[model samples]
Target: MNTTNNIVPAQVIALKKQRVILKTETNEVITVNVSKGKKKDKVFMLTMADLLRSGLWIPVNRTLRQLMRYDWLDTPVKSYAF
Candidate 1:
């Protein structure tokens, strides 16, 4: 398997009702998760930190480009490895 990565720019926006959204230039809303025990910003930042630490954060540009050349979309959510 080939493992490569890239980064692209995106805008992180907060919505009402404690929801966090990631909006791309193309107006794509990638993921939306609600804030649980912390502030919206804190939750979003920590979630991003986890994603980055686990190598699951992929920029939207790279995501779309890779979709054309790759057979599978990159997984940004942690998956069970056991």
Candidate 2:
């Protein structure tokens, strides 16, 4: 039940009642809750939704801002702390 540590490729299936259902490569599915907010916030949410839909998951410790800064999504994680 602890799926947080599981590394699985997931794809978005549908959205209902503000939740996203992700179907993994193994056929396992998980639903993630999404928040409804203003248009500004929706931009960020949509980006996250796209990532999930593409079967990519971001680590909890990293922020979207950091990812945007280094283009790590298309590359690899680089240490920016120095």
Candidates in order have lDDT scores of 0.45, 0.50
| Residue pairs with backbone atoms closer than 3 Å in model 2 (clashes) | none
- Most accurate candidate by TM-score: 2
- Residues 18-55 of candidate 1 have per-residue lDDT tens digits of 54345556666654444465444564457554544554
lDDT of 2 by residue, 1-82 (tens): 5544454445566656666566656665666655565224665557666765675654321111122223544433364454
RMSD for all candidates, in order, please: 10.3, 8.0
Please give me the total number of clashing residue pairs in predicted model 1.
0
Q: Residue 37 lDDT in model 2?
A: 58
